[model samples]
Target: MTDPLLTETREDEKTAAWWRQAAVYQIYPRSFADANGDGLGDIPGIVSRVDYLAQLGIDAVWLSPFYPSALADGGYDVADYRDVDPRLGTLEDFDAMVAALHERGIRVVVDIVPNHTSDLHEWFQEALAAGRGSDARERYIFRDGEGPDGAEPPTDWGAAFGGPAWERVEDGQWYLHSFATEQPDLNWDHPEVRADFLKTLRFWSDRGVDGFRIDVAHMLTKDLTEPLPSRAELELLDRSSGRHPLADRDEVHEIYAEWRKVFNEYDPPRTAVAEAWVETPERRAKYASAEGLGQAFNFDLLVADFDADQFLRIIADNLEQARATGSSTTWVLSNHDVTRHATRYGLAPLAGRPVKQGVEWVAAGGPEDELDRARGARRANAATLLLLGLPGSTYLYQGEELGLHEVAAISAEQRQDPSFFRGASFDGLGRDGCRVPLPWTASGSSFGFGADGAHLPQPAWFAEHAVDVEAADPSSTLSLYRDALRLRHLLQAEEALVWTDTGRADVLRFARPNGWEIVTNFGEEPFDLAADAANVVLSSLALDGQLLPGEATAWIAPA
Candidate 1:
C-alpha cells in the first residue's frame, strides 16, 4: 500500500529508533566477558557474547562505562571520555565491538558519568593544583575559610556509601564529594565544565552510539552552603572520603535540557537515559519530558518489598506519573548497583527456609516438597514476565534471566567496592555481588567468560548453574528466559501494554490487543481462573495447573 521509497524510510527509522517498545540488557563490561587471559573483561570478550545477547531478543545492549579511568568507582570517574580504558581494550577494539554488535542489529548505549571525575583525572588535578582563586579551581566545588575543624562537615548529609559528605582539601579549604574523596564533584554552573561535558557526549554520539545512560544524573548540582552531618558520622566518613549533598537543586534539568538539544541533533535521534532516583512522581516527570531527558530509570520497582499490593501500586503509580512525560518509562529488576531481586524478595528463601532449584537445584524427595519449589519458581517467573509485558521499556540485568541469587558468602577481602571501603555495611558492599562475572559455561575455569578466571570472581554457584549447563538441560531457567523473551517480541500488538482492572491486588492482569490476558499470582496460595477466562496461554509452572515455585502463566482464547 506504500511506495518503495516510503517503505524504505520506515525501515530506516525502525533501525535507528532509540526509544520504542523495547528491552535492554545492561552489561557491566569488566564483569561481562574476558577474551584474553588477562583476568579482565575486554572489547573482544564482549564481542564474543553478542550472539548470546541477541538470542535473548533484546533490541540494545547498555554497557557500563568503559572510558579511561584509574579504576576508581569502577570507571564512573572517567579520566578521558574519548578513549577506551586499557584494562578493557583499545579504542580500535571498541570500534570493532561496536561494528560487530551493529552487524547483528543490536544498538549500543554506554554510560556517561558527568557529575564528577577521578581526582587523578588530569582536569581535576589541574583544578586542585591551580589553588584557590584560580580559574581551574572554578571547575570544581572548592571552598575557602577554616574547613571542617575536626567537627561537623559543611552539610548534615551522609555519603551514599556511609559517613559524612564533605572532605577537607587543605589547611583552610574543603571540597564537596558525595561519593568518595578520589572522585571530586564537577561544578555544573561553570561554563567550561558544561562545555567539556557536551564535547564528551557529542564525541560518543558522533561515533554512532545509540544513546547514553547518564550516571547519578540528579547529583550534578549541589548546595555547598548546607549544614553538615552528625559529628560522629562525619569523623567516620572522613576516614574514607568526605561527602556532599544529595540531589540538590532543580537547576540540573536546565543543564540536562541543553545536552538533550545536542542529542536530538542526530539524524536518527538519540536518547539520554537519566539515572535520577526521584522520590516523588512530580519530580520524576521533569526528567523525562520533551524538554528534559528521553527516559529515566524508575527505581520504584526496586524499592518495592515484593508484595502483590506493593508491586501493583508501584507499576500503576509510575504509569500515571510518566504518562505526561511522553510515556517512556524504564522497568529494571537487578543491576550492577543493587542486590538481585530474587534474593531481595526472599523468593530464594521463604520464611527462613531455602527453596533449592536451578544450578544448585535439588529434586525434592516428595511430591509435596516438589510442588512447593515449583510454586516459588512460578512466582518469580511471573514477576519477571509481568515486567517485560509492561508499558514502555524493560531492562534485564546480565544474569537475571538465569534467576541468579545473591552470593551467601563473600569475604571482606573479596569486597573491593567503594561503598564497602567507606564502611557501608548493609547497603551491600556496593553491588559487588551482582557485578560478579557472568557464568556462560559450567566446566571452564572462567565459566565461559575467558580463558582465565576473571579479575573479579564469579559467584561459586556458577560451577553448578552456568549457561552452558542449563542450555543443555531443557528444563533450565536459561531456557525459560529465552522462551519468555521470544514471546514478548513475537507479540504483534500495535498499541502498548495496558493493565486490566482485575480488582485483586495479588493478581496482576493485563491485556494486549492480540487477545492475550497476562495474569500473575503473587500470593502464597492458588488463584482460580476467573469465570470469564478461557484457557492458559503461558504458564511459568508445570502442566498440572499447580503453580510451581517461582513460575507464572499467561492466558488467552480456549481451543
Candidate 2:
C-alpha cells in the first residue's frame, strides 16, 4: 500500500511541475462563448464560464489570439499585442476573465504572434509612409523588386495561406508578408522589433498571464541574402545545417533566449511553448530547450493515422524528444486550424493511407452521409484515454470533450477563413468547419452560445452533443470525460510508462509503473481482459461484459 506521506509528497511535486504534464484546453475566442449578444464570444462570456472549465478538470486554458486584429487570419494578424480587441472585450473585461480563471485554480496561456503584425499596426502604417530604406521600413522585411523595372516580387516563396510570400508596394519595392497581404512580416534582426516583443511579453505577464504560446516560432529571423533560394531549394535546406534564406534560421534562437530572460522575471518565471513546425528532433529540441521557451509542440500525433503502429511510432518519437529536451512532450489531436478528429476518423483510409479530410468533405453533408460516426467517436474516445494516460501534457481543443464533430457544411458566402478566399491552392482547405461556434445547450438561435446568433454557424446535429443534453446522460461523452479526468489525477501519479505486448494485431497496451493497465483495441474484434483484470476503473466506451469492444479503451485496476 502507498503511504499517505509519499502520496502527499507526489502531489506537492506535481503542483510545482504542472506545466510539464498539464491538460490544457484551447479556446478559440470567437466560438467558445458569447455575451452582450454581439454574435461573437467576449471576455465577459469567458468569465461567466470559468466554473465550467474548472469543473472540466483542466490544468490551464490556452486562449488563442484575442489581441486587436482585423480578423484577416482569424485574429492571428495582430494590430496590437498588449490589449484585448474591442470586439472581444475591453482590457478591464480581460482582467476579470483572468481573475475568474485564477480563482478557479486555472492557469492562463496567451498566444504571442511575433513573426508579423497586421498591416494596420502603427509601425507597419509608418513603414508605408516612411518610404523605402527609411528606419520605419527597416523595421519590416522590405526588398527591392527583382528584374529591370523593379515590378516583380523579390522571392519565389509561397505564403502559407496561399499566394506569393512577397507583395509589391506602390513605391516599386516589395515587402515580405508570408501570410495575408494585410499582414507584414517583421524583421527580427531589427533591434526595435526585438525590444518591442520583449515589452509585449512583460506587458501580459504583468497582467497575470501565466504563459505564452509563441506563434510561428520557427519562421522568424530570415536569412536576408541576395538571390533567395527557391521553394524547392528551401526544402533541400531542411536536410542541411546551412540556414535557409526564409525560415528556421539559426539566429531565431537569439530572440527566444532573450524572451526566456524576460520570462524569468516573474515570481515563478512564466512558462512558454513554441508553435514551431520543425521536422527534425534535434532542430525541435533547440526551441524546446530550457534556455529558450522550455517546450515546443510535438505535432506528429496531430496528423498521424488511427493505426496502432503509427500511434506507437509517434508516441515513441515524442517521448524521445522529451528525454532530449528534459521537458515533457506535448500531444494534440485536433485544434482550430485542422479538421476535428471526430470527422477525420469517420472516413476510411484512402488506399491504405491517411485520408485527407478537408472542407470539401465537410461541405458534402460530412461523414454522416457516407461514413460511420459510431466508429469515429469510439476511436476518438479511446484516443483520449491513450493521450491522458501518457507521461506528458495533453492539449484538448474546446468542444471535443462533448464529442462535437465539424459542422455538416458551411456556405461559401459565409466562410470566413482567409484560406477560403485566398486562392484555389486553399480551395480544399479552410478551417471554418472546425472553428464553428460551440453548442452549450440543446436549443437556441446559436445553441446557448449567445442570445442571438453565433459568428460561425453550428449545425442542427450539434444539439445531440450540447452540454445540457449530454450532462444529463450517464453514458454520454461528457460524463466519460469528466470521469476520465477525475481518475487521471490519481492514475498519472506514476510518470514512467511501459508498453506491454498484447501479442495481437492492431492492439496497444501500456501500463503506468504504479497505476492501472491501459488497453486499447484498434483491431476489428472485441478484446477479452485477462483474469487478473478483476476491476475495471474506467472504460472509454461501454464494455461488452468482460470483453473490451473494438475501437475502445479500458483502464483495468493494477493486477
| Maximum-TM-score candidate | 2
lDDT of 1 by residue, 106-138 (tens): 888999888888887887778767777889878
Candidate 2 residues 1-559, lDDT tens each?
A: 1111111114554554678878999999988999889999888888878988988889899999998998998999999998899999999998998899998889999999998999999999999999988999999999998789988887788887788889888888899998888889999888999999999999999999999999999888887786677778776775335276666778889889999999988877888999988758888888888899988998887667678988988887777778766777898988877767877677665334333445446521343466668877888898888898788889999999999876747877788888777763322548788888889999989999999998887888999999999989989888888887777877766455777778786888877767577898887798888573468878887777788888888887775
Clashes of 1: 30
Model 2 clash count equals 0
| Candidate with the greatest lDDT versus the true structure | 2
lDDT of 2 at 421: 76
Measured against the true structure, the TM-scores of the candidates, in listed sequence, are 0.85, 0.94
- Scored against the true structure, residue 431 in model 2 reaches a CA lDDT of 79
Off by over 4 Å in 1: 1-18, 145-157, 170-172, 225-248, 347-378, 425-428, 492-498, 501-505, 530-537, 545-551, 555-559
lDDT of each: 0.69, 0.82
Model 2, residue 388: C-alpha shift (Å):
0.8
The alpha-carbon deviation from the true structure for residue 414 of candidate 1, after best TM-score superposition, in angstroms, is 1.5
